[model samples]
Target: MKNTPLNLCTTRLHGGEYGLYVALRERADNVMNAETEPIYGHKPARYLLQEIAAGNKEYSELLLSKETVIGRRETGEILHELALLQTHLWKAGRVLRVRFLEGPEHVHRQIETIAKTWETHANITFDFIAQGQAEVRISFTRSGSWSLVGTDALTERDQNKATMNFDLSDETTSPDAFPATILHEFGHCLGCVHEHQSPAAAIQWNKPLIYSRLFQAYGWDRQKVDTNFFEQAEKALITNSGYDPLSIMHYSFPPEFTVPPTPTPHNTQLSAQDIAFISRCYPFPASSTASTLLKG
Candidate 1:
């Protein structure tokens, strides 16, 4: 894949390289299914026993990722950019601080209003702060909407600069751009990678169509298209063998974008699988999600 520095799917990492940033997939990949055993991110037995004994099983699940990957996520980078998806995850139950560097109050309000939908299902929270160094500093620049996924948002060279963006000047460019784009970008902030990149998405893309369409629509070159759409994320991000085409994180592909012309509509809201992914990644007390190794 081409090493595109900045474009759509702006998952920033070290060395100015853009990549996917999926948090829980690295640690709590099993949270998607209650019946299946966890594949990764198991907490220590002593901590599990303590949490269970204290009746705080829910919070313990939230601690799974951080506690599990203390030294695990630092492996060698792979050719398909798998390591790019594996890092910068926040520990579960983190209150992600958000601040708008510049935008209308109503836009900010709408952004916050829509963001709560994700919070209801996940353990993560968004604290929209007026001042201070925020994890997500959003700007309404014309440079197109993008975000530094996961904890990478905190890695900006200039702390005062925006780590996320909302280019709302051309809302008519896509359906449900107001809230859908917001949800899509915030999904990145939560360490959720693009659904199209999921291993389950065995989409036979119309290559020529994708290249031309993206070039005409978003001004993205072939390399950027390959980096964002053609590339697939690791199987660790999959909750099940089935791909979720209705996922809010999946881009709205026109009919011609696919080989068989299967079109993905503009999804303004999160899918059931999207909820499950987020919930598993951010275990809440109400969800009662268990760690992979521990039976609590």
Candidate 2:
């Protein structure tokens, strides 16, 4: 499809503290797949509601749209693509400066681990020395509740800073992938968008049935589901062309998540495309440009 202007849409997922974005289809001929059962076991619908109410206004707006609700899986992937697109569009060179708030060990260590991976894959240096300032904070409020907050660069009298809040006591038992989630959210803190939503998000969606199940369970309409889950990532792609379904931002919905229980190769970590996207977004530039790059 030829380059087009941004299509106006809204999100349907209920958000409370998590970031949410809607995915819109770039083309009209794409049809929905109907070969899977509608099961609500993949992702909890309540999580989507909580994300709709997240602190970030932009995030909340994107998740509450009707179209967004339709593209259940696409919502998460598109956000990552948008975050990556922002980095490329803004062109931040590669140097990244990060500040970690002195907080709990579980979340702090998880952030640190993810920070290291980001530093390696993003090909940039990150500074975590905040002295006493809390740029990124991770704490728990209650069961089944977590938060990730971030702010772009600022030039006011007060020094610019970004922060994130995570409920360590939540359902994040597997801390290995926890770093990837933190990195994904941190990408937002640095003004990054989802990699899949970048104009390059053209994955064939090998498992449409799985996606359909997610949509049905969430009670999302067709338009919202399509935009939030499939097409939005290809809307404003920053790269030439290509889709990465294995992106860390991509949801873990595979064919196996459907019915029949067949052997399907599934990945649980970030893909090579994700690493490349991160590298391109966070180019290794200078410290001064780090903040500048974070601006847009």
Candidate 3:
């Protein structure tokens, strides 16, 4: 496989947050395997619904993009890829099991606390299991923080390995560690994408400046910059909650990276919109009667 850049730096708060980034570049000689699944084929129909619930219209369009038809031999059985706008929520009220493959026990509790903030508003529940295959396996390494989006966690071949990773090793002990970063990665686990990538967010990016800074800061090449910062999610795939500049899922860009020199703020907590959006996506069953009535 060709070398693909790692998707690091979900929250680039400062130089300290990038400690792992520097180490990873030196260790891998500035190249790492993409280690992600292919994007072709039908993802779960619920993902489409999840996008819609987040108020993205492009998701519905993406669902209508194309279909694959499979014809059978003797029995004339046929398989077809249909575009269905279904809820991508975990089995309605299922407890998503999580486990830590690495990281100190203290940090594990911290991670759990940060993750469960989503449960306060959303109907989803996370159960941290002591053993066995967990729905979300979290590990720590020099690789910058990232998590597989939503149901893609189930597609991993190495069941014992982690589907998510954070830069929470011993060397990365900064006071500002698990605030927004944990919320951002867990947002990805719940099927959220970078808020900046939303088509509605018309950020006037200073492309040359962004490219130059990232290359110098993280050893990122042109392709990596494009994929991580410039490439917009397919309108059909995005569940836009309207261009929220304060969303926990947004990255703080330096003033130099923007056209008019506007410095994007580092969001330390979930914005009110973030809470409202997740609530809509995974509302408490009892309080979701209005949503059900609307659907009906």
Candidate 4:
């Protein structure tokens, strides 16, 4: 029951289509299975936005066919630029409060210890509170680990509910995987996307082979495979950080996934580039007064 790393997409509506946006959001939320482990949940709204921004003719036609009017003024260029800027990083100098919704004391202690490793380098702070509303609520489940990306947690309807989950209940989650899993999910919470999806990575994926493997392994259909693996991210949507195959944000791919059999090893720790990139994204100000609280 080892949880796969899943990225949650956040949507922003423009052109006063708040009603339409809400309808879309409700549809997306309702379809997400709370117990199912999604390799990358097939998020139509997110997929539509990404595709429309990339100017994919097929998706554009699909949007039009569905009678979904992306406002005339909301050009693909504007959406692409805005999506790139907003989704790349969180606001600096923010104290993100984290609360444990459900977990044994030992597991909670371990998570608290490992999660703070990011705070040592980044400007952000993870304040673990006991009895108040928190920005990040964590819980444990048998399904694979996942988290909403960055500011998307703030948009959740249940403000006090858990926004991140760890698969501690899974007996298959080894001790070696614990730190990596926690760090990886927290990476998502910090606005980092899968390193494999980095526009600069330029991975040569063997589509038919990948589709066959994912379908057999995860019950994913053609659409899910295309959305999760085959889709190339918009180059403009990426941060300036150069690609690093060693990033903890990357999932190890087997040789078969690539045309020339490029096998990426499973990364269990943050690369040097990871620290530098996160630091740049959330730089600590010299005049900052907030204290870093490390819980053992």
True-structure RMSD, every candidate: 9.8, 16.0, 13.4, 11.8
TM-score of each: 0.70, 0.45, 0.67, 0.67
lDDT of 3 at 219: 71
Task: Tell me the tens digit of each residue's lDDT in model 2 across 51-166.
Answer: 54474334544534455443456454444333333222222433444454334665555676665665666645455654544333333443222222122221111223223444
- Model 1, global lDDT: 0.64
Residue 76 miss distance in model 4 (angstroms): 13
Model 2 lDDT vs. the true structure? 0.41
Per-residue lDDT of 53-157 in model 1, one digit per residue for the tens? Answer: 477754325333344432444111221133343434566778888888888898889889988888898888899999987777989888777787676664464
User: What clash count goes with each model?
Assistant: 0, 56, 6, 1
Q: Model 4 misses residue 134 by how many Å?
A: 1.4
As for candidate 3, its clashing pairs are 46-87, 46-88, 58-235, 58-236, 59-236, 123-282
Tens digit of per-residue lDDT, candidate 4, span 169-212 = 43325687778878888887887767778778888889887677
Local accuracy of candidate 3 as per-residue lDDT tens digits, 194-232: 788888888788998777777775677898677667777
Candidate 1 residue spans exceeding 4 A from truth: 1-9, 14-88, 172-175, 286-296
User: What is the Å distance of residue 158 in model 3 from its true position?
Assistant: 1.2
Comparison by lDDT, 1 against 4, better one: 1
**Which lDDT values do the candidates have, in the order given?**
0.64, 0.41, 0.60, 0.63
Give the candidate order by descending lDDT: 1, 4, 3, 2
